[model samples]
Target: MTNTQIVIAELPSDSLTPAHFKQTTADMPVAGDGQVLLKVILMSIDAANRSWMKGATYRAAVNAGDAMPTYAICEVVESNSDRLAVGDIAASEATWSNFVVADAHKCEKLPKVPQLSNLMSVYGIAGKTAYHGLISVGQPVAGETVLVSAAAGSVGGYVGQIAKALGCRVVGIAGGAEKCKWVTEELGFDACIDYRAPGMSKALRAACPDGVDVYFDNVGGTVLEAALFAMNEKGRIVCCGAVSQYDTETPTGPRNLPGLVVVKRLRMEGFIVMDWTQNDAKALRALQTWVDAGQIKVTEDIVDGLENAPQALIGLLAGENKGKRMVRVAADPS
Candidate 1:
């Protein structure tokens, strides 16, 4: 049978653009010992894809001539391992493709949950990353005011909700008015500021009048600067992502970082989800419980077809996605 894959043929030295991807065809691989064949169901698009565009030298997780790296929900079509069944749904990091041959050891059994659809979302890696970043780094406490950048994004969305659940007053910073509304009304953020508006610093200051105890940063660069200025004494800053600089060839440096940290005695930390790989299943279960109880909300933008993968990735960098950006390579034939 024929198999299709998205390959990164040319290296992208600058920003990651869709033009870097090259689609190709190949023969499907047969199931090997301790491996399972999966029909791709859904795959996520994240800024990390951009890092892989430079090839594997810097990021060992991805390489040239290799399939684009992604996190996906898949259906096992064939299994040589005893743990997985033909119809079982599993989540794995299997870039862009219609079929995947994954080591049985690498797959995670998707647990049954109330909002099953959100298991691939709020209970997914993105959700867990947000949760851990906020709690482990931001360390919000009851009555503390937490501020989050890109508050409408998948990670930011969870950060806001998690803080609110922890009894902290939450403020969100997004690019537009609609997202600002969702931050306050839907996600229960105490307030939201539109970063694109004039006087963003002044607005953020006013909205966070009590100062920011925790700052979950999804969009770095200028937003980081603004958050630094408004941080409360001894505040904690979580460096979740630098999305604001993803599309630029030359990323802007944060000029006010030293002042913010030294003057306020603030603490800032950066973490990758893989650091908690050992705790994924544990975190997933906790997030799933929250979703089952309607305590956390997840949104996903799904683009159909493997052919759309390149553009789907491009859309993510352009801020076209409201939540977890994903590509749907196939619908359940059943």
Candidate 2:
């Protein structure tokens, strides 16, 4: 069978446009020497996916003539390994292609849930990332003022809700007026500041008159700078993905760093959720509890087809997606 994949057609200098990627179809590779063949179900699109196209960081870049790197939910259709089976479902850090063949080491078996689509999103990497950032790093307390940047987006949405459920006064920073309304009205944030507004710092200050006790940041640069200035003494800053500066060749970071961290006595930590793998089960259980009690909700923007995966990633980097951004490669098996 032919497998279609989105591959890097040209190297991007600063930002990505449609021209940087191309769709290619080739015969599906066979599982060999302890490898398994996977059928892609759905793929998560992330801002970091942009960085991968640019070359060299924690994960190497997908240069010209290379398949884009991505994470996916898949079914193990054929296995040559003792660990994985034909019917097993898994989460993998594989390239963005219709089908993948790799050893068991790169894939992790997923938990069986009644609703795989919805539950996979919550129990997947996004949920775990939110848990590690909010509970592990931020550790928000009741009555504290919590501010979230990119608050209407996937991980940001969860950060605000979880902080609110902890009894903290939650405020969010999103791009547009519509997202701001949804964040406050539907997502339960006390208020949301449109960072795209004229006076962002002033608006955020008004939203959190008491000063921010916790700041869960997704988009960095100017937003991080603004949040830093709004932070109360000893406030916790959870550094998740920095979407704003991801596209730049020489990505500039937040200014006034010491003025906030040293003067404010802030505890700012950058984290990769995968580092906290041991706590994955605990975090998943907590997420399920909150979801069951109606304290947590999962929202997503899912696009269909492997051919449109490049556009999904493109839109994701441009802040076009409202919730957790994903692309459905095939119909989820019933």
Clashing pairs in 1: none
lDDT tens readout by residue for model 2, 1-334: 8988888898888778889888888789899978899998888888888866666878775789888878888889999999899999888877778899978877888766665566446777777888888998999889999888888788888888888778999999998899899998888999999988899999988989999998998988999999898999999999897888888888767788986689989999999888899998899888889989999878888998878887887788877888788888887777
Model 2 misplaced stretches (Cα beyond 4 Å): none
Q: What is the C-alpha lDDT of each candidate?
A: 0.82, 0.85
TM-score (C-alpha) between model 2 and the true structure: 0.96
Cα displacement (angstroms), candidate 1, residue 198, comes to 1.8
lDDT at residue 289 of model 2 (Cα atoms): 92
Whole-structure CA lDDT of model 1: 0.82
Task: Report backbone clashes per prediction.
Answer: 0, 0
Clashing pairs in 2: none
Give all TM-scores, in the order shown: 0.91, 0.96
Candidate with best lDDT: 2
